[model samples]
Target: MSTRTSETTVTFGHPFRLAAIGDAQPAGTYRVVVDEEEILGLSFLAYRRTATTLETPAIAVRGGPHAFHRVDPADLEAALEADGKAPRSV
Candidate 1:
C-alpha cells in the first residue's frame, strides 16, 4: 500500500466554523492537507482519500504552534462556499 499527500491553500473572506474545529476561525488563508492511498489490484492507477486536515491559527498568524484538525471535506467546502471564496484550481 502506498500513500501520498497533497497540500493546498484556501482563503476565507469571513469567519468560519467547522465542527471538527470548535470555535469560529478568523478570516484568513489556511493550509489544507489531503492524504490519499493507492488502490491495489487495479489495472489503472488510482488513489482514494484517506484523510483531510486543516492547519489552525491561519497561515498569517505567528508565535503559536499550529495544530492540524481533521475535517470533513464536505464541511470545508460548505464553509468556503458560504464565505464566497470557493477553492480555486492551483
Candidate 2:
C-alpha cells in the first residue's frame, strides 16, 4: 500500500504537477493536475518497475487531450477570436 506524504501546488504558467511515489523501496511517477479554479483531476501512467527504488515522479500540463500541429500565437489568437473566446493571457 502507498500514501501521499507531501504535495506541492503550482499556479503560474501551467496547472499541473509531476509526483513520483512508490513503496518505501521503489517509487513511481504520477502526473497530478489542478484546474484553473484549483480542483484536483485524474491520475494516470504506471510504467514498469525499475532496478533502483523509484523516487518522486514528474508532473506536466495536460497540453490538450488531442494531438495536433503547433500553431503560432497569432494564428491561435485568430482561432480563438473566431470561436468567440478571448485569447489566453498566459
Candidate 3:
C-alpha cells in the first residue's frame, strides 16, 4: 500500500491547544500536514502548525459545503505512534 500525505494552509479562527506542542496556537495562517488512513471509519484531517512543530490528531470538524469528515482522537494517536512520533496525550 502507498501512503498519502497532504499539505495545506489554514487560519485558526479560534484558539486551540494541543499536547506536547507547547503554548496555545493563536489565530493565523498555518501549514498543516496529514497522512492518509482510515481510522475509526473517519478520514484523516491535517495537523495544525505550532510555533516549532506540528500538532496531530487534527480535530476534523468538516462542515460547510464540503464533504463531512472526522477522525477519532484515539485513531490519530495511533497514527502518530505508527509514524514513530510521540503520541499526543489522551
Candidate 4:
C-alpha cells in the first residue's frame, strides 16, 4: 500500500463509536478507506477517512467507492501553501 492508498468497504455490525469525532455512527454499512503510504517497510496511516454510506451529506466523499491518495502529514503544509491557503492552526 502506498502511504496514502489503501482502501476498502466496511459496515458497522453495531453502532460504531468514533471517539475522535465524538459521534456514534449508527449501525449500517459503510465504506472504510485508509490513506497511507509505505516507506522503508514502515506504514504511516492517516486518521482521515472517506467513510461513506447510502445516505446524506458525505455522499460525495463516501458515496461511490473510488481510490484516492491519502494526504501525508509531511506534504500537507506544502500542498496547502501551494494552494495559497493558510495552514490550519490545529
Instruction: Please report, in order, the local distance difference test score of every candidate based on alpha carbons.
Output: 0.90, 0.28, 0.44, 0.38
Who wins the lDDT comparison? 1
- Which lDDT tens digits does candidate 2 get at residues 2-88? 222222221223222222211121122222221122223438533321111111222343353522222233443343344455555
Q: Of 1 and 2, which scores higher on lDDT?
A: 1
Q: Estimate candidate 1's alpha-carbon lDDT, on a 0 to 1 scale.
A: 0.90
TM accuracy, model 1:
0.93
TM of each candidate vs. truth: 0.93, 0.24, 0.36, 0.37
The order by descending TM-score is 1, 4, 3, 2
Please state every model's RMSD to the true fold in angstroms: 1.7, 18.7, 13.7, 13.5
TM-score between candidate 2 and the true structure: 0.24
Candidates, ranked, lDDT:
1, 3, 4, 2
Q: Candidate 3: where are CA atoms >4 Å away?
A: 37-90
Q: After superposition, how far is residue 22 of candidate 2 from its true place, in Å?
A: 43
Error of 2 at 29 (Å): 25
Model 3 clash tally, residue pairs: 0
Candidate 4 residue-wise lDDT, 1-90, digit = tens: 334544344333454444232344455543434443344443654344332212211223455544333333334334334445565421
Instruction: Measure candidate 2: CA RMSD.
Output: 18.7
Candidate scoring better on TM-score of 3 and 4: 4
Q: Which pairs clash inside model 3?
A: none
